[model samples]
Target: MDSSLYALVEDLRGVDAAQVLSHGVSSITVGAAYHRARDVTPHGRTRVTFRQDGIHFPPGDLFDGLRLLPPVQRDADQEPLKALRDQTRELGVPLHGWAVFLHSTTLGLAFPDVTQENCFGDRAAPADLCPSNPDVRAYAVALGRAVARQGMDSVVSESLHFGMFGHGYHHERSFVDLGSAAEFALGLCFCPHCQARLPGAETARTAASRLAASVLDGGPPATELPTVLEDYARSRTPIVTSLAADVADAVAAEGSSLTFLDLTGAVKGYADGRPTGGPAADSAWQIGVDPSAVSDVVPSYAILCYAHDEDRVAEDVAAYRTALGPDTTLRAVLRPGVPDTTSSDHLAAKVTAARKAGANTVDYYSYGLVPLPVLSRIPH
Candidate 1:
């Protein structure tokens, strides 16, 4: 089950929440480090919770001497994670930590140099930290170590890859109509670190800039770019794979495992859950996530199977299973509520499908986001 500190602390109060979560799930994955959001908690003490972009726990010495440091949330004083940990331990349930890395507007705003700079030399999405930057990599390692040291069985790493152009910003406004291809080109980072690391960076930047400019001048949208774009995307894999390896090593050293969460499935199925594509895994390259390369480094992987259809969920999981191979652990994350699930039976079917298709474990999307009754849809 996926949950949040606010949900455990304010909604069900530590013990009761842990007991409730432990019912139909093998383990509870709580948000230890998260990004900014104002979510409506249907069954929470407060109807809505405004979460700040920061780590929920005190990072004490974890980020010491690092150029980039994580911001601590105000609710850290309540020690929600600690309380949940204690409750879960008594209940004989494993607790995992969910950490959102490389996607923080607070850190980006504080240290603009670490944020991704687009081809036009603009920090369009200040929330996205360039993974190519050494400081960002160090911060990711430190975050994994800190969360692992908190007694978490595994750290579920989210947003550890690059961000897209249309997302990750607050109140973002763009009057110009840029198609998906153009937006993607604009999202490509041309920062100093990326330029130094990415091969043919100058050529790729020029091509991306021209593509965006052509679209801006009322030209029809182009679906594909020059071969340089393909080469540029391929080159980003090594950077992300290396970062995942470092985080996995850090987490392993701290006696915990690392599960890299790929958001490609969520992006494809979050809306209607009727995604029409080859497979979510195949499209992960757009975000700099190479599943096969990451699997070689990280032992476990998690993919969001947000589709309503059991077949769709199975297809997505099967693709990841093929990419990661049989040895690597694969967890399928499903949403048991509207747009993705119609009822308990529907959710159960999806779960069974995912397992049959090679998912080692099945996890629900969230606790507080949906109604209390909706959580019952989770298959035991």
Candidate 2:
């Protein structure tokens, strides 16, 4: 079985790289474009031992014209990526660069015009970047090449698609009922670039407003609006696919492959520990993700199987395998602790189910986030 573990730069300071390989983990996916890391030293919890820092790696020369945000300020001696890559290579374990592309509070706060604009002409989400914008796409391509140049054999892409209202800002309060239609409506992006491609954008915007108002007034949303809104959402599919192709080209040029993770399953119900079906399975389209269309362009498709039940995890894996088909690599990511996982045996069962469901590779959600004992939960 091909197994890989995800890690943050903070993990390297406390956990030994040799220990990770000793656990039968053949590959390590380190955060390259991560937003933040809360470090916990080996010593017991103390005020001095805890610290939070954003931007794991430093900015390089390739990001000159990208109009991107500068990485979190660091001391002159900090060099996390180079150190981790060198140690992992010496241990004979491949290092895959983990990156978050579109979701950025830093960039959105710095440049609000490029952030997603909701139906009510609200630009409150500073975490999401509009993929339709030329500048956003250019920056993503540059980031892809930069990660590859850092000696990563492959790159894992996250948050590259459309984002929901709850993604960016913190301390949110969605007091209204916000039925399914209203939720989708509230998440739609109607920025200038989005409107340019959507011919019926005004009509869709009106429908979203009405649906949201009805929910806010303690009433059910009209049924007809979801279909209309979905049509508008689907219009952005080609643009998303184009951006994926551009990033793929960039990664290939630098001698690395791209593994695009489809977070739709988690969005549907996997994260809630429930089975996903019907319209929820297709919700990836709302965020401009048509996995089937982009399967040929990217080398691998990763499915987020954060569900509780092993059987449902297998079912989700099977669905992704069918969507991407046999030609593309299907990787499944599982959470080994917290709400979904109970014990190592339970984690092992989920891993077995993923393999039986046609997963080409199985990777865990994170390393530093989980306790040292939980690392034993991974199947060898």
Per-model TM-score, in order, reads: 0.95, 0.91
Looking at candidate 1, the ten consecutive residues that score lowest on lDDT are 1-10
lDDT of 2 by residue, 1-380 (tens): 55788876655665566766665578888877766334443322331233222346666677786776545535313867777788888877788998888887778888899999988899988878899877888888988888888889898888788887655664478767666677778888988988887797898888888787788788865444567888888878888888888998999999999989787767766446664564323567867898888787898888788788898888878867777889999888888876678898999899899899889888986776666677678767
Candidate 2: give the clashing pairs: none
The lDDT per prediction is: 0.85, 0.77
Once fitted onto the true fold, the runs of candidate 2 whose alpha carbons sit more than 4 angstroms away are 36-54, 73-77, 221-225, 269-271, 278-281
Question: Candidate 1: which pairs clash?
Answer: none
Separately for all candidates shown, the number of backbone clashes (residues 3 or more apart, or on different chains) is 0, 0
The positional error of residue 94 in candidate 1, measured at the CA in angstroms, is 0.5
